[model samples]
Target: MPDERTHARAQIRGVKETAEADLLAKKNVIGVDIADKVTDGKNTGQLSIVVFVEDKQPTSKLSAADRVPKEIDGVPTDVQQMTVELQGPSMQLVDDVTPQVDTTTYAVLHGGISMGPLRSVYLTPPDVTSAGYYIFAGTLGAMVRDRGNGATMALTNFHVACVNSTWSVGDRMVQPSLLDGGSSSNQFGSLTRATLSDDVDGSVVTVDTGRSTTPSVQDIGDVAGHTAATVGAAVRKRGRTTELTYGTVISTDFTVTINYGSDVGSRTLHHQIRVQTDTSRSARFSDHGDSGSVVMDNNRMVVGLLFAGSSDGQWTFANPIQSVLDELNVDLMVAPVVTRPIVSCLNTRLVVCNITRPVACLFTRSAGCNLTRTASCLVTRAVACNVTRATWCPVVTRTAVTCSVFTRAGCDIPIPDPGPIEGGQSEDGHGYGATADVPEEYWAGYLAALEEINELDGPDEA
Candidate 1:
């Protein structure tokens, strides 16, 4: 969200203005305290009437008056009467989630994402009961291309798509409002499961509007024509709610954590990210309403999608553009590709794994091989080690680059099954047969890497 100075200040002014509007919208009744006859002493049987302004402020101008109210408090109401504040506006959230926004940043993104050059569409799990209504305002670094028929698919965070639930196949998606355009891109898109991977979040009854795609601020001192940036390169993001911001990919060892879904809340992807950015844009990057902002590189190649970030932008993380490609398996490459690292076990000399490579993560062992490469690495009290083959599966974004182990059960944390009519099961990478679960194209890459590492005996001495 934007800074309180700018956004909040403006909002405060606006809220006050609105409250002043409703200042006279006061209605009172001759009511009695229909309590269980409790004793606050004085009015055990009678209740006091009150008057209030309906906005962010809580205290109403009229306290629990012994008499009924005389006016319908609203804008026409006098300032003195408007000050007749009441308890309500500053109450708990009523719907989705509270959009913690900096008014200025909201103004920015509200212009762009809600009204950018070409409106971007996002696919989220639909409310089947609502006839598959889409979750508007999603972010995407890349989209998916189906291997089955080479169809294009939307790629975004699993949580953004409502993973771990029984969503009807081919559900619809909705885009958010931005800029001057309200319901501008009111088009709906269809989605089939290309891939889904989400972690757990704590037990919350429902997702807030904030969790989906809220707002934040960033201040990119106008780059000429928005010439984009690249990996190992610095970039800036201009958000709808946030102004402009900068950040470094400290690590993409993307491990998100979840507390609710593993059991009680019974769903995954209710989590947050840890980002790393400089102090200039660090104070604020993105917030609640800025969820679907596309993070452009210096080159503006859309390196990452700005979904979540800290209030104070100290450290930040992003779902890599490459990872999005791998997840949905698509290509948005307008720039030449650079070679990535190779992971191997120094101790076992086994060809190690790359978690976010968007390709084969684990490779078979090469006898006598002693080196490995992984884009993500972490040095705990113990030495920095390969994340894939560790005993514990280190969460990618939420937990940072921690050691992760491979066990069928380890990755297969139970998510609730779909309701009776919506029958489908999440994949569990099991033993040999599980290998079949690997797509042919994905397996081909793995086989090539494995053969190279293991030096599989070729047809010899024929």
Candidate 2:
């Protein structure tokens, strides 16, 4: 069912070899390729010989016959200039000025693997007071593994994590971010390697084995793995700034010029994937602080790493996740489930209920509870949890009171409980005291009774 124009293009594609040789024979013609004929920014479905030239109008003393071709093999030709240049990290260009310190709570370890935004960290060359630390804000990106030895590493933009080539390998990387008062106590990893290629802007930080870490991301859950990106693929992401969002890949093998803000000059990047936001779906592809977030496909496969974008949110760019992994010589760290002690409880009917492993409870009420995944039982209460993927495992709640639970980064549920109240007046004007004398052995039965009453009142009654 090919149209006339499509047939013509197919014909042109077959005979383009002869056209390319003839075009290259002409002066100033550097390269040639078969291309679609575009008019008014739309492809007409017709093919042409795209001729590359040094100059459209050469001022040198050359004969008229030596000029670039206007047509080849009776097909139209386009004379275009394509000069590519590569630049290193932006901090290298703007190191003369004092960097502004951004003290914000990005990410820091509270339990095991904690994910968050990255505020600027201060680093200086040895014995140089005049030197300034690289300062900027971006997401932590994701966790990856060393290809050679299977060691885990942290991933992010070369500019964001390495301060645009300002820091050296073995330099300290902290969390809660220095802007948020990070110090030696907050050190999470160290710079191990990095790459700034025509196709990528990335760095790898070797995770400190002494610290607790997880490969899971916030809201989006664990990254199953990575794959090559293709046009029209549905994609999603989670970052410190933008918790979770999704869009579709509109273009691939894209080349673009990106601005690095005020002090840093612009640079060109090639072979990028372009994602367009669907405002109707309230989609957001990227933002200023979202750089380094891993972009995943609808299948939960990692596709790209978000780096740059238009300020208006119309378009965004990402290096192929496969390319990033290859460039860094590492593989993605599969998300791991949290391990906790086994805990159980009794429902309102006095029947012992065995809470499953890897379950998270966002909230608990008298009548029901919000679990990370749906659990079915013949009890009188309802248990609800958001299920995104099937890999969710059991973990303990951040606030472990009685037998309640909470989801981890690899699970699809929100943290549901508030901190335990100490000696204070209850909302109902009942005063609670630590010194209140109650029979110790009766505590378990009393708590079960209290929970029954709470469930009967439901979550809203709180």
Candidate 3:
């Protein structure tokens, strides 16, 4: 009586149950998940199971690829590389040299919602009293609505919301964090779910009905929508520490082990989007208090939830948006559309000065505006560029030469010609134009675009 999709899912579950122990016992194999097969950027519409394998390089003599099986219980299986460490609940120490923000100032600027990145703090008795309270701060990822009941919830990292998995359900989470002068009055939500697994390192807090909250991310504006991330997509985020920062997707499906200090040791996270810092901005994309910040693509769609970063802040990681939505059983609140102010350029064409926030321009391939090169757009007497929402370029080229910030780190001033510019400009809330070395900052994003373009052109061009 079940549809093929449902039947395949069920069969895959059975295969996992039967082979989980043996499969996990194999080298590098840690976990399993079910998903549809994607071929040539299109979903095959056929269900398949995913097997998780760990380590920097997944390979083995016992099995074909690290002992991973191509099929389980007659269902096709795919392997995902991940990192596993032995980290427990503990606050990450903030480095003095790392770029930091003043919590009190930003909290006052945003209002209602307590916002800041890192500081010292407490979690109270049951969660942890040994060190009094754990001192930590992470970005409040976003406000999500439960799929079943439509109840609003606060999304953040397990380390941010659950005290590194120490806190249980019903435990209160405070904003400005305890270390930033947060107390009972600032309690925003209670832990409803926590996941420290192969798929995610996150938790959801059921926000108290009485508290003031919005589905909007500070500085960057509203959550226009949600989408899965692809390598090379230009993304941005507003966090407690950095306020607003930008970066490029280096790898969408990546795995790495994280060292969570001595007591917590380390833990492996699977299916993560690895992002490198925008060289044009501060060298680091995020700092101590950035964990739990929700990353949005150029089109303002939720892409992933930030969790960890390297000491230098150059490298950062996140759980894919789809995985978070599924695991939490929640949906992002879609921001409403609003008309934006337009400016007339040289009295010949009307140009939308700021189409990146609050309202998105939907004119793709409209009259006089059909430039859709990777991360770049051009329009004359038009509403929007022909570029897709997932595009890395947000720049709009016009005869008037007024350039707006694109979503990717490499996006910069509009060039007269349509040939792809070497690199993008930097967006750190500063009006920086593209430099000759812009490509260096956006090498990762540009490389991905080049690969795609090369594939389209075929073997001769390659």
Of the candidates shown, which would achieve the greatest TM-score relative to the real structure? 3
**For residues 173-248, what per-residue lDDT tens digits would candidate 1 score against the true structure?**
4333222232434323444553334421100011112322212213322212222222245666654444466665
Off by over 4 Å in 2: 1-134, 180-184, 259-267, 336-462
Predicted structure 3: clash tally = 22
- Whole-model lDDT, model 3: 0.58
Give each model a TM-score: 0.33, 0.50, 0.50
On lDDT, the stronger of 2 and 3 is 3
Ranking by TM-score: 3, 2, 1
Q: Which ten residues in a row have the lowest lDDT in candidate 3?
A: 354-363
Please give the lDDT score for candidate 2.
0.56
Instruction: For candidate 1, give the lDDT.
Output: 0.33
Clashes of each: 90, 14, 22
Candidate 3, residues 1-462, lDDT tens digits: the string is: 236655555666666557655665567665555655655557676666656565524354455634666676578866655543322222433322322353452222221133322334443443343545345555677888889998888888777765543456887767766555555566666778877777688788787776766668787777888998866678888777666888987555455556544434456666688777787965667776677888888888888888876555666778998898888788877667888544323342212222322111222232444343332322222223233222232344433333333333444434343333222223342112222223433635633554554355332200
Error of 3 at 39 (Å): 31
Which runs of model 3 end up more than 4 angstroms from their true locations? 1-133, 259-265, 338-462
Please report the TM-score between candidate 2 and the true structure: 0.50
